[model samples]
Target: MSLLTTLNDDIKTAMKAKDKETLSVLRMLKTAIQNEQIKAGRDLNGEEELTVLSREMKQRRDSLAEFEKAGRDDLADKAKIEITIVEKYMPEQLSEEEIRQIVQAAIDQTGASSAKEFGKVMGAVMPKVKGKAVGNQVNAIVKELLQEN
Candidate 1:
């Protein structure tokens, strides 16, 4: 099933199971995804859905960090729970080793020899890594590889 369909089914399951926390998070996810679709002026493709899911997860992580910084462990814990719920829908995150392999391939493909061509190498790599690899992780790997080259 498509991610959207799975989400809808999961929402119903959460509701029926009386999983209040899961239901609330799922509802929020549904709302965010619908908002993204409206913004795009059409239904999102699978790739776009993954993009939205990634963005939501990133936002939760940032919020968790801010909450912890302010000494609000209660709020941070809630955000962490919400992040776990959100992550259920995300594709498997790439490991550092896997990400490095992809970056190396991109460098070879683009013939990128310096940090100055980071964007060029990134453009070549992103299509293959999107949704699987987080942006910061990919960028760090690319930078490290380029610096070593």
Candidate 2:
């Protein structure tokens, strides 16, 4: 099933089971997806859906960090649970080793030999790693590898 279809089914299930936390999260997810569709003036492809889901998860993580920083453990805990719920729809994350390998391949492919070519290497790598690895982590690995080369 498509992620949107799955989310819709889960929303109904949540409503039936009276899972308030999950229901709220699912509703918010549905809203986000719908908003993206409206903004684009078309339905999203699977990749676009993943992008929307990733953005939602990132927002939750930022909220979690800010909540913790303000010593609001109650809100932080809620954000953590919401993140867990959002993560259910994401593809399997790439491991550090896998990400590093991809970065190395991109560097070789682009002939990027220094930090100055970071943008070139990143352009080559980001498409392969998108929605699979953290952007900053992949950038760091690329910088480290380029500097060593």
RMSD of each: 1.5, 1.2
TM, every model: 0.91, 0.93
Provide the lowest-lDDT 10-residue window in model 1: 127-136
TM-score of 2: 0.93
Q: Evaluated with TM-score, which candidate comes out highest?
A: 2
Query: lDDT score, residue 29, model 1?
Result: 84
Per-residue alpha-carbon lDDT of candidate 1 for residues 12-131, written as tens digits (9 for 90 to 100): 999999999999988988888899989999998999998888888889988998999999999999999999999889888889999999999999998999999999999998888887
Residue 51's C-alpha lDDT in candidate 1? 82
Name the regions of candidate 1 deviating beyond 4 angstroms: none
- Best candidate according to lDDT: 2
Tens digit of per-residue lDDT, candidate 2, span 1-149? 77789999999999999999999999999999999999999989999999998888888888998999999999999999998898888889999999989999998898888899999999999889878877878888998999999
List the candidate 2 regions with Cα displacement exceeding 4 Å. none
Per-candidate Cα lDDT values, in order, are 0.90, 0.91
